[model samples]
Each structure stands twice: as structure tokens, then as C-alpha cells.
Target: MIEVYTDAASKGNPGKSGIGIVIKAGKADVEYSFPIGTYSNHEAEFHAVIKALELCKVQYPKEILSFRTDSKIVVDTVEKNYTKNNNFLPLLERIQELSGHFPLFFIKWIPEKQNQRADRLAKEGIHK
Candidate 1:
């Protein structure tokens, strides 16, 4: 099993943004921070998940994916447990489509403090 922790942020609702991801496989931990340009935080969150999935394809193609994120918009939308506002529909659809590629997937919402590493990456992404 592989655990990927992800997070994203925007300076404003529709402003500079970034996506961050931390992948853990046994004793190895890898971190990624990507500048996603001007977008809403929700969009950045989706980007983070997409980026994480892409990385997983290279590093753990056959492993079950368990992802943790603190973004309510992302977690709720992916779980199909909540309705998304119109602004997020496109990204939501993309995420739904991406999930089809995985053999097994799980995404859960965790407390922001518990998702520190990814959070740090996201903040770093903002500046880079």
C-alpha cells in the first residue's frame, strides 16, 4: 500500500496557486511542489491529486492508492458525498475521469495540521 498526502493553496480565491504532494512507500518519502499558476484553490487541489496519480503510475503502478487531503472541496467531490459549486465542475469531472485509471483508490480528508508536509510543499510551490 502506498500513501500519498496532498494539499494546495491560492493567494486569493482566484489567484496564484500551487499543488503539493508527499508520497510514502515503506521507508521512502518523496515530496513534490508544483506552481499551478492562477487558479482557485479548489482547482489547485485537483491538480495536486492528478499530479500525485501521475507520479504513482511511475513509482507504484500496481499498488493500491490511499490518499489524504485536507481540502473539503476535493475530498467531498471525489467521494461523491457533496454537491460542488459550478466553478468547480470542470476540475471535478477531470478528477472523476482520472480515478478510472486506478485499480484501487481511496481519498480521505484529514485535519490541516496532520497534513503538514504537503502543506509546506504547497506554500513553497506558491513562491516558486
Candidate 2:
């Protein structure tokens, strides 16, 4: 199974935002950061997962995917496969579509400290 850690940071609510992701698959480990224009922190979190899944789709293909994020909203929304928030609906749809490319996909919520690397990358991304 491939392990993925994702995080997002925003300078302010609906402000400049970015996403960070770390992927671990056997001996290959990679880190990624992206300045994703502007969005609220919650939206950024959702985008981080979407980005990670997209990356995995091209690189890992039929691999099993396990994702970790510091955002409970992302974890809950993905586990339940639903979100009532309108802003997240489209992003959620994209995530759902991308995840289906893998043999299996799952996400878990991690504490901030446990997600420090991705957190740092996300903070750095805001300025990029």
C-alpha cells in the first residue's frame, strides 16, 4: 500500500492558499507543494487530497492508497463519501472520480504534530 500525507495552509480565510503532500511507496518517497491560487483553509485541505490522488493515479496506478491528513473535514467527507457544503461538492466530486482509478483508497485523520512535514511544506507553498 502506498502511504500519502497531505496538508494545506491559507494566509487567511479565502486567502492565498496552498497544498503539501508526501507520498511513500516502498523505497520511493516524494514531497510536493503547490500554490493553489486562493481558497479557504477547508477548501485547501480538500484540494490537497485531490492533488495527491491525481499524482498517485499517474504514478502508482492500481496500487492501494492510504491517505493521511490533518483536516478532519476532509477525512469525514471522504469516509462518508458526502458533503453538504456547496463549495466542497465539486471538489469532492473530483476526488471521488480520481480515487476510483486505484484498486483501493482510504483516508485517515492525523494530529498536527504527526503531520509536521506536510504542514511545513504547505506553509511554504503559500508564498510560492
| Runs off by more than 4 Å, candidate 2 | none
Please list all clashing residue pairs in model 1, or write none if there are none: none
**How many residue pairs clash per model?**
0, 0
What is the per-residue lDDT of model 1 for residues 1-128, given as tens digits with 9 covering 90 to 100? 89999999899988899888999999999999999899888888888998898888878888889999999778888888345487677667776666667788999999999999999999899999
lDDT string for model 2 (26-119, tens) is 9988999999999999999999999999999999999999999989999999889899999999999999999999889999999999999899
Candidate of highest TM-score = 2
Best by lDDT: 2
Model 2 residue 117 lDDT?
Answer: 89
After superposition of all CA atoms, the RMSD between model 2 and the true structure is 0.7
Error of 2 at 100 (Å): 0.5
